[model samples]
Target: MCGTCGCGEEGTVSIRKPGEDTGEHTHSHSHAHDHQGHAHEHSHQHKHAHSHAHEGHQQHHESSHGHEHGGNGHHHRHEREIQLEIDVMQKNNLLAERNRGYFEAKQILALNLVSSPGSGKTSLLEKTIKDFKSQKKIYIIEGDQQTMNDADRIEKAGAPVVQVNTGSGCHLDADMINKAVKILEVEDHSLLFIENVGNLVCPSLFNLGEQKRVVIVSTTEGEDKPIKYPNMFQSSDVCIINKTDLLPYLDFDLEKMKEYALRVNHQLEFIEISVKNGEGLNKWYAWLKNLSL
Candidate 1:
């Protein structure tokens, strides 16, 4: 569920390559769920609580599932929400550490690319794969609510790609990647690009055990975006200021955008690139190269 918009169902993650044999590589988690009486999730779009009715509570059971005050069993909703968040994140963090260890043992570089919709993440990836596919093996795990459109784009760019259809979910968690990695049969000493669901808030709260988190933002969206979505920026290791090729026709100020982002995260590294026309992308390629060193 998106912490910002509460827009996900308590469900499983599905992973498959577009046009691949279902018998060979098909995985789904339809039965997975939390056991906490009434579990709620937060999405990037909104905050809505999802509840499930449970038995064995000492309080009087209301038909409407509302909490009525009782002698010794009434608990505050706010406290419940806090506890839910802690439980969700704690489980995710443990799995994320496992993922980190797995990648470390294989000498794989996993990078999580997070951003809002239409941030040009796919284009940047296509360009990266086209250039470096020969130099190193690159695997892509594309996350979207539905459809394999982005996965298709990455595949045509000549890279190994898997699509994770999150159904109503707004972000991908570490466990989902664990399943994808098994199907991907990823190679060692390679790059694994996890293009997380197009979200700025919910994805920030879920870590996938990636070595670095790259937040992509375009100039057309204006510089205030970083300030508006500070949580995403603060957690990210680097910020990619994309669409520099359109800077001449627009009123976007590059310096101010970085300033606003830096206000939230003082240590974030910035990369200015025009993935469309190949401007200022050497730093990006160079950065990736240095990661292996």
Candidate 2:
């Protein structure tokens, strides 16, 4: 009796030698049926490699004879299998759908505000909330890895606010928005603004059930930002060139930035504003009204 098998000698274990054309061999076993008629199959023509087994004590081996035969043919097959199995960005898309449905149910016009830190997402929201407080019941969902500072500013503007701390997560997902919505007392005629964690990359991939996605690009960040971070601009329905008040001080090319943004996303509607001076905000508010309506 073989110590490894723990089975009788009648149970035969056969090992086959690697063929001349064989680069590598792999084995997979399934015990759905009895092993009495089990057989192994091999192919030399197939560049990719895979294995399937049915109820058998099968052993596979590799040989150096064909090791350099087009650089590990079996390894390439394994890689293809792995690539096929990957979801890529399925998780994020699914979560985005859930968030979208939730917002639809609530009848809340949610807006995702994305930008680099210090691009004045907070200040823009602050000014907007102050101006629109009398006419609209605005609610804010502030997302940050730490601190309640943004939410605090929104609160001072007299709008209902909820702060979501994502911990180490770089972006907000549907689950976060789902929970954040509960804390916000959004009425029938209400606007929900989600201040996405300041990031040009990660935030664009996430959808927080927002009616609109607005990307804030500051003049100080330069006109090349639209070209460099095309994904963010591409995803946004609106692009706000904030801090235009400093355009005189900085050598920012406004026309070139608009041209680049249009090249990337022809449908992008934009507003140039400075929250400090309250310039270009009325146009923004008007656009928001038309969208919400």
Best by lDDT: 1
How displaced is residue 4 in candidate 2, in Å? Answer: 44
Candidate 1: 10-residue stretch with minimal lDDT: 41-50
Instruction: Give the winner by TM-score.
Output: 1
Count of clashing pairs, candidate 1: 14
Residue 267, candidate 2: Cα error in Å is: 1.1
RMSD of each: 9.3, 17.1
Q: Per-residue alpha-carbon lDDT of model 2 for 195-214, expressed as tens digits?
A: 98898988887676677899
User: Could you give candidate 1's per-residue lDDT for residues 85-129 as a string of tens digits?
Assistant: 356477679889999999999999999999999999999999999
